[model samples]
Target: MNDRRIPGPLRRRPAAASLAAVALVALAATACSGKAEEEGGGGGGADGVATDIGVSDSTITLGALTDMTGPYATLGASVTQAQQLWADQTNDAGGICGRDVELVVRDHGYDAEQAVSAYSETSSQVLAYSQFIGSAYVNTVRERIDGQDQVLVLPQAWSADLLGSEYIQMVGSTYDLETINAIDFLAEEFGLGEGDTLGHVYFEGAYGENALAGSRHAAEELGLSVAEQRIAPTDEDMTAQVRALAGDGVDAIVVSAGPRQAASVAGVAAAAGLEVPIIGNNSAFAPQLLDTGAGPALLANYYVASPALPIGAEEGTPAELSAAYAEAYPDDQLDNGVAAGYSAISLLGQALEAACEAEDLTREGVAQAMLAMTEADNGFGIAHDFSDPAAPSSTESYILRPDADTPGGLTVLGDPFTSPLTDSYTRE
Candidate 1:
């Protein structure tokens, strides 16, 4: 649970000597094929694989625009480190597409301006973005990434607003769907139905607003009521918000903000004698929170809904990744971010390998390869279909309750599930 900030941009490349030999061979094979040179900024490799901006004879570059000094600073650090570990493992296993994978990381500190600036600065150098962390920031450059550049971008944010872009790959269920599942879990827990009211406290941005949409839809379907409280990302103290929800007599509260906000909501609500179930989206809970003052309250009443299995899940991939991540960074705390970051890049690596097999490693090639993937699984207890650009990878979410004794501080309440209500959800 190191809360230290990463000061500047960091670049990482796998150090494998075999990559040099592979590069020499590619250069030799493409020496006479000047057609790649004539076609803008690409070249041919050993397997006649076409190369582009991020792809070279020996390396393929990807970008990671993350938040290391802002609201999700600690989570962002774990995710970034996990991606780096994935890169190392991929290189060790004979690099993808006959080249080593390199990650060029930029920390945007969760500022919109800094996010856009980081994207602008690194977009040209990388073949695609492996990890873009913010919803609004990604939206700001959606047109450019989807229309102009047409490079594949796997975003860490899961707003339904990000869907339908041909090149933007969403790995998990969107925020809205995740919220629907969370609200349902809460309702079922409290045995509330038609007459119950739920309070939703969320950030005033793409991420929170998207989840709020879910709460509204769930309310409509389940014949319930929703009371909304929108707050900025900087508003950490939840005393006022909790009291407002308490005044509304909400049976349960849905929080779609960061861990700080979630903790505040739990602490304030418990202190105010506002005894109601509290739920949050995937990014809302962190393992370190169990060591805080709100730990008991969270363990008693808080729940989280996530699109993927957490690091503590007793699944094959989660088990493997948890071990690898711990070994890679012994001092770092185990969290779902490690699982998320690895999953995102592992999927991207699959696309890269597919592009190489298609003999076109250009941005367009990688994008097409991704779209063509009808079935993809990273062994995270769920299967994803990338064939549809208008829909998210999956509609299923794993409902979890906080447990102080759990490895990741949360335990799955049941198997991953897709609510029947999800089928009626229309992506907006």
Candidate 2:
């Protein structure tokens, strides 16, 4: 993995810039049409003729609304690269059900308004959204998607609320479930069972609150005490929060924010001479942290709970996928984000293939295909079952500890963990 921070210029590569410009002009020219193209003749059944917005005789267009220039740009870049790789491979294999896949990537800058504007411009030209990067931006356009009958593959699985959207397919466990599994792993790993105090440092929103719900549930179930401090996402320094947790003498700290916040909490706690382990939700940790001044602190204390196995997990589909990615993009870092992007696209491909088989290649058909999926192989160790509409795609997760030898700066602690809480968890 590269230790250097992602350069700003890398976000605006000339090829992508030109693609965006052309897409914008094309969008403007067809803005008044307000109707999708109806090209026919494809691999679907008689009724499965391609007539949707982005489908044609030889191509199927999909849109990716990502944060290429925002706070999560590094993660977004990895995701976009992975998606492109999947599309390229699919096209090379005679395309999905005979039509080539065309992926249109757009930068939303992690801003709600920008995401909405970008969606509006590209909505009429695409069959579905292959990626919607941020929670806030997804919320901004959630209603629009439902109204337009468009299916979306969401980047964040932090909120159960997203499950309410019939058109959205979440690729992994919800934040709450991930946290529950994390607590279960930590309790067993550290031999600190009943009566231990757990501290939660979180951002104040659906993501944080959902994670807190799991912590509180675990506390009740395991006879542990809980303390919490909520902060804004913009808050960089967490010295005061760590001080408070330290003062409370919490046995462990659970972070439900982003990478910067994770770095801050770990660094601050270490600076305060507190030594309890600091566990982070999937979104909380990034490999880039290893390159920062806080690397030592994170390496010493930070553990991550993720729904998928690390890309480099030994002798499995994951390792194979990682090898393929390295061959495709040798210079790029192989991290959880890249794995996530690949999994999302892989899941979408399954649905697309199913839709093609059923001869119903419309947006509704894709949603139906996804909902009908009994299980999906992510090209990783885990397989998600989506047969139950009310259940999440995944409910188990692996506990990862930082390791210098791993591509993602982390290695799986053991086999993936699943608690009874997973089976019963549902959207509130």
Steric collisions counted per model: 0, 1
Candidate topping lDDT: 1
Question: Which residue pairs overlap in candidate 2's backbone?
Answer: 45-359
Q: What are the clashing pairs of model 1?
A: none
Q: Which ten residues in a row have the lowest lDDT in candidate 1?
A: 9-18
lDDT of 2 by residue, 229-258 (tens): 999877889989999999898999999987
- What overall lDDT goes with each candidate model? 0.82, 0.74
Model 1 lDDT per residue over 98-154, tens place? 899999999999987677677766767788888999877777766567655677899
The local lDDT score (0 to 100) that residue 225 gets in candidate 2 is 90
RMSD list, candidates in order: 10.9, 9.1
